[model samples]
Target: MNKRFYIIFTVILVIYFILKYLSGFYIDFEWFRQNNGLSVFWVLFMTKFNVQAMFGTIFIVLFLLNFLMIRILGGKGRFFAENFLDRINIPAIGSSRKLLLLIVTAVVIFTGFVMGGGASAFWKEYLMFKNSVPFTGFPADPVFGRDPGFYVFSLPFYKFLYGWFMSTLVIITIFTVLLHVLNGAIQKTVRGVDLSPFSRAHISIMLAMMVILYGLSYQLAAYELLFSQIGKFYGAGYTAVNANLLAYRAAEVISFIAGALLIFNVFKRSFKLPVIVMLTLIPVYFILGVIYPALQQRFIVVPNELGKETPYIQNNINFTRLAYGIDRVEEIPFANKRELTYADILKNRETLESVRLWDWRPLKQTYKQLQELKQYYYFNDVDVDRYVINGKKIAVNLSARELTIENLGVNSQTWQNQHLIYTHGYGLVMSRVDRITSEGLPVLIIKDIPPV
Candidate 1:
């Protein structure tokens, strides 16, 4: 009774704290509704809560389905968990199973909620993928021939799905196998490991599912080659395009066929085919997926890297330029033959005449000394710029005289000094780039404070 009372009290306290924490979101929601329109708040509300609930429900449903399947196939009464089931000294067998079920169920719910909550933070990623706008009027990737939009908008969603399914499959398989083993459907014999006919057939189906998932993973890896940093530059270079691409395709095909064969093995008396196929797959994977790619990269591409990688290099240049939104810039190779002449100078006289002579690196310090009237005024930069003044283009040096309040004496940095006394920066300081005073300071056109 005392143990039961403590448990009840702990449950009540946990519920109280959870409610208190959730109450904070209620205040946030009310504020959002008032300040940010109801529609805006609702959109954010639905995106987070709805997405989280949806994916979380999927995890729970999967667990429940696998749990039910195990119960049904393994049969309840025939469980061989003797002597308290893993040393759990419960008084009654039924009570022991119920307690174990409760713990497992709680763990499943907690894990599902956490995983789904994290997944839903990327709601924007899911939304973008659902309504992806293809990038138009751009050169596609040379290897896979996909638009930039595919990688930006779609790859993340596919990867998330892969992870979601793969993790769930792994968990389900382990749980099912363990439960079946506990039910005495699978055991160790003097000869070797033994399996009941029903267990063998049921487990065979799961093996088929895993093989199919592997096929999907292999196919997805093909797209990921574009992001590979296997060469001089990122994206599909020589080895990736020529080697990894072929390997992944072949692996995926083999994976699919192997999955089908595993399913067929269930009908046969003995499971010889699956073991053979699994063993064969490893060496085949190493050859087609590893050794072949390695050989192709070393023997084929390395010997004539420049010639082979030239086309890929050009592809990289185009894609890199596209990434920076400067794809439209025209490229023209420089010719070494022509010598620069005065006529060439005369042709571009406007550009030549407006060139800045002053370097900004030392000019900023000079401005701080010359133009900072009060110690607080600071010239952080000297910028070279052009001005069209009365039918003439003139180049000039400009600097914003920013008020650095921290430079004031510590005691004088009071509220009034910062806000009221030095409320704003004085003004801009300007000068001609080519001109210098007798003291070797810049000749000032827009001088600050008291004139010298």
Candidate 2:
């Protein structure tokens, strides 16, 4: 609305564009190739435009809506705004100089604590990922070994923290502003009334409860799913697991009830029943919901698992085989003997011919050169697997993964592009390893799934 504000905004836009160009240039530089960690910071900084745009849009819409609402409400709204601003200024808090100093001090202290904690956690995990000895697990590709090309070359952990920090700060700030607006609106509507729907204490408690609920939601959801899956497979020693799951669910239900009661009390200004319930539930939750289950699992479940190892082993084998599609293979049991026969070789020719010897690293490069349809469609890695085709076992090379729109280019990663236009990647590109087309491309065996 002012010339100074416009000047500052324009300067920020120019600086951001300059930095964006620099980041892209640096990514292609040989220096960046040698020092990948430096690129992480620049990439994270350049990629923050979308998040900034989102929060900026939210702030602008809220400001406009507040202005329109006040205009509709007439003189009362103007008077309320004036009174609110007046009350916000602390009485006899000394001169403007002192007030500015105090504000600066408070900001420094607050940011120091917040940023210190974030940096500590970030560096701890960064070092862990950086110095980690690669091992076989969910995140590791078994065929290619532990270190996937993506994990080895990219600073995913740093990028994740950067995104999390930016999004959390933006969301929290937006919600805080919205909450302030709502409080002011309520106060304006109930002019001169003693009873308010939301007191400062009530808002503070609710905010704290929200953070707790966010953490509990993830914890409870993960454990609930784990126990449910375990119950489906291992029915023998699942009673303790079931009891532990029930305890967790019960705790979650009680926590939700407590939060609801707190909200209800905020509006009704009721007696301290909600406070009493919350206080009581905390201990009850600790005892019945946490301790009891742990004790039961330790005493009953451990002994039972030890005694009945065969069933548990069978369940594990069944689940693992099913998960990896090992059970789908045609199994033909044969007697072991000191023998070397052409008959055995003939019988197992299908399996022998399906053995993959082509290195994936070079194959990935070849696929990128020949198969990539567009800039967005990336061929990151090659996977080799044997499949029964027309009653014959054949090995196939494919890359099922595709880069997200955000990874395609910054310009193509608008809100609609990310959230709507292309929410997920296209399907796999597959071909027989030993075959080539006339144009020197891998023989197209199975193209994109869903036909497009």
Name the best candidate (by TM-score): 1
- TM value for model 2: 0.38
- Highest lDDT against the true fold, candidate: 1
Candidate 2 displacement at residue 41 in angstroms: 17
Give the distance in Å from residue 55's predicted Cα in candidate 1 to where it truly belongs: 2.0
lDDT by candidate, in order shown: 0.78, 0.54
Candidate 1 structure, TM-score to reference: 0.64
Q: Please write out the lDDT profile of model 1 over residues 72-181, one tens digit for every residue.
A: 86553332344224445344323656666866687688778876887777788788888898888777777777887998899988888888778777776787777666
- Give lDDT: candidate 1, residue 156: 86
Steric overlap count per candidate = 0, 0
